[model samples]
Target: MAAEFDTLAEWTAQVATDLGSSFKIPAACRGSGSLAVLDWLIDELHLSHGGSLLDCGAGMGGPAAYAVRQRSVRPLLVEPERGACRAARSLFGHPVVRASALALPVGDDSFDAAWSLGVLCTVPDQLALLTELRRVVRPTGRIGLLVFVARSSEPFPHPDGNHFPTEARLLSLVEKAGLGIEDWRGTEEMAGPTPEWQSRVEKVTAELADRHRGQRAWQLAERQSQLIGQLLADSTVTGELLTLRRR
Candidate 1:
């Protein structure tokens, strides 16, 4: 039988099944445009067999594993969280490095391409993260990123205390880190508020609360959903997908 889903939806649904409801990808990341994003990443990075791809943050290993299987690319996943690293290693069977994005353990020019999804916002030092990525990836190597960017300087309340940088600030950081932005897409253009997303969020939250007994994971899930919903509702912060090349 054909795969049930070709995008984040299937992967996240499965994650929710395995780790209760708290581990699912946010509704904001599951949309019709997700397949297009995957296609763009493959095409822009020119992924192929034997080429090394670095998955920064590498959350749950779903998207990275999907990309590797789809393109036959070798991947080295770097995740700071031990739980996430374990999950990635077990699920993808890919080599995983438990390290921070600011300090990648890989040697210089180790990867042909690198990408991160919904991770940049969690990083406090964008330049450090991007610099590490640039150092690890070969010169002129392609980089693709999808980040939640702020529309203003005011910090957005988040469970992770992540920095939601303004578009200009984020672009500046990328350029400063010696990467050139080749193209960009905004949230509305990528995955705006999808119909039924609210219901999905409610269901996930309720399920997580039940399973985790409203513990840390459940609370985090609820807060994350609230943040995403607010971002979508106010249009204050938007998801930005960028195609970049290391310089």
Candidate 2:
């Protein structure tokens, strides 16, 4: 029997909780797009002060390493997936632990900068994740995030899922989570994607496909590529960073 589902929210809730290697994202897209976002996030966090960084859900260490390399900041990572934690450690030997966003295994108010790079959208309790981040950062410290959103429609719930919060909704989530934002914006306006990005993606896809053999994984990758390519080609994502500061 096909697995039964009650509502889109039900599926979404599951996806938000899941952290699998084969998410609906092309590895190439996740990497390059992350690099682009980090460039801007780094600049913003640097102004406030840049050290003792914590990267929530540091999958593959690409983003952390990128931040360290470009911004000259070392990042401690927390991820729920043992696979991701191991993979990240193999690549950089940075400090990373297997943990969930809801319960961080760290002391409170210890970090100067904390960030969630494409990590917040999944966890069932957005408020819990945000609160943990807030708890770990000093009052004036900063938190950066990159999450998925939709306007009229929310994301379908798979193991690895997304949430599309309205601007007002997002602010509420942040405030309730016990933190306030500093600055936030959409990638399409300053960063996102361009037509020429495909040239880069095409090159990367060819190199990785042979290594990644699962059919479902490959198809999901293709689908996400199309969606992001479209998002890059033209800004279509409903969610945009609504910059905030903790009160």
Model 2 spans > 4 angstroms off: 1-34, 47-50, 153-160, 192-201, 220-236, 242-244
For each candidate in turn, the TM-score is 0.79, 0.74
Q: Which ten residues in a row have the lowest lDDT in candidate 1?
A: 1-10
Which digits, one per residue and each the tens of the lDDT, describe model 2 over residues 1-247? 0111112112222232242323212231243354456678777777332477888877655567667766677679887766566556644678988888888899988888877766665566788888888888877778888765544344433232445455666778987876666777876556544445444444345544554434454556455546655653443443354333467
- 1-247: candidate 1 lDDT, tens digit per residue: 0111112223344455665433343322332235456667777788888888998877556666667767988888887766666555545578888788889888998899998887787778888988888888888688888888777887556545567888899879998998988888774664433445445655654554565543554455456557676875697777778888865
Superposition error at 198 for model 2 (Å): 7.1
Index of the highest-TM-score prediction: 1
Q: List the residue pairs that clash in candidate 1.
A: none
Residue 227 error, candidate 1, Å: 1.5
